[model samples]
Target: MSHPMHDVLGRWKAAFDGHRPGAMAELFTEDALFQGFGPAVVAGQDAVRAYYEAVPDDRRAEVTVLHTYTVGERVAGGFADVTFSDPTGWEAKVHMSLVLRRDDNGWRILQYHVSRVAAGG
Candidate 1:
């Protein structure tokens, strides 16, 4: 059987591939916490939208789930390997973790963190 979270991640990937920051932010909760490759940890949907909007138009991401598990009926956690590429032929790989919660609106991200992985590691 297929995992339900697969569908959720698919929507998230589609948003990024389509370069729609608003659509991407809609996948998170209102008070979601987001920590990208930078030192800053952002919270809230508006901030998340702003963060994603700053991504260069030429950049895109490909995600591969490394692990996933359910914490409970309302919570789930997962990690993914994300490869980001740009028009300049530059590519960077990062490890991403997400905590999702099920609400009336369905599964939404509550926490997200990402760290860059060494190219040759």
Candidate 2:
């Protein structure tokens, strides 16, 4: 049987790959916290949606889960490698960490952080 968390991540990946910012934001909690490559942190669903929608349409991402573990009956954490690609063949890799919490609707991202991986590292 596949891990339930895998399904959650899969949905998240699909949303990103499909370029559906609303769908991506729906995977997060109302008050979720997000930090991308920048130092500024964005909070809440609307902000998250706006942040994702701002991503260039020419870019797409592939996410690979590196590790995951349950923090409690309702909380889990994981790490992933995210690769962003554009039509010009430009690519950038980022390391990501996520915290999820289960609610009546299922697991939703509570906290997400991503940082760019140094080139040639």
Candidate 3:
């Protein structure tokens, strides 16, 4: 079966690519958790909004999925490279796992954990 999670991920990519920070927040649930900014675990829709807003206006995120495999309900794992447009040109290849739940609004990410890939990983 095709995982609907792919669509959510695509929307997320499009949101960031177009510099629509607000759209990015829609991908998460009301109390979703994000680990995008270092060790800080940002929680809640409003907090996520604030986090996205803090990013430079011209900056954007690009995600290239390396792999994806679904587990039990609301769980999946994938590898991807995320690059941000910044002065230092920061880039990260991370192994990510997402926990999603199907609600009245369809699939939404509830928790996301990402770890930086090792050198040559």
Candidate 4:
């Protein structure tokens, strides 16, 4: 059976597919922290938008939810498997932690952390 986490994940993916920064921003809180590809920390909607925009065209990820759990309106925790081809034509796999909140509207991500996994190194 599908979970609430799936709904939130779908919303996040939709934001990415549409490439709508404003829509993506709406999916986060005012003080959300998004740690993307690099080590830099992106906070708030504007910063998140800028960070996402900086992603190379070829650096698109397809995320698959491996697990998820929800705790009240304050938090939702999950791990996802992320696979993508980099701009340099190399495939990469990443493990992502998704943290979101549920308000009157719906779930909004409070934090998103993606960590790259070394391949057969």
TM-score of each: 0.94, 0.93, 0.75, 0.83
How far out, in Å, is residue 74 in model 1?
0.8
Task: Indicate the worst ten consecutive residues by lDDT in candidate 3.
Answer: 77-86
Model 2 Cα lDDT, one tens digit per residue, 18-113: 888999999999989999877999999998899889988778788888998897689987899989999999998999999999999889999999
Worst 10 residues of 2 by lDDT: 1-10
Alpha-carbon RMSD, each predicted model: 1.2, 1.2, 2.9, 2.3
The TM-score of candidate 2 is: 0.93
Predicted candidate 4 versus true structure: per-residue lDDT over 6-120, tens digit per residue: 8877887777765666777788788889997889887998988786676554455688999998787568879998886665877878898878887776778889889888877
lDDT, candidate 4, residue 118? 84
Clashing pairs in 3: none
Q: How far out, in Å, is residue 27 in model 4?
A: 1.5
Task: Say which candidate scores most in TM-score.
Answer: 1
Residue 89 of candidate 4: its Cα lDDT? 75
The clash count for each model shown is 0, 0, 0, 0
Provide the global lDDT of candidate 1 against the true structure. 0.88
Q: Sorted on TM-score, highest at the top, how do the candidates line up?
A: 1, 2, 4, 3
Ranking of predictions according to lDDT: 2, 1, 4, 3
Q: Which portions of model 4 miss their true places by more than 4 Å?
A: 57-59, 86-90
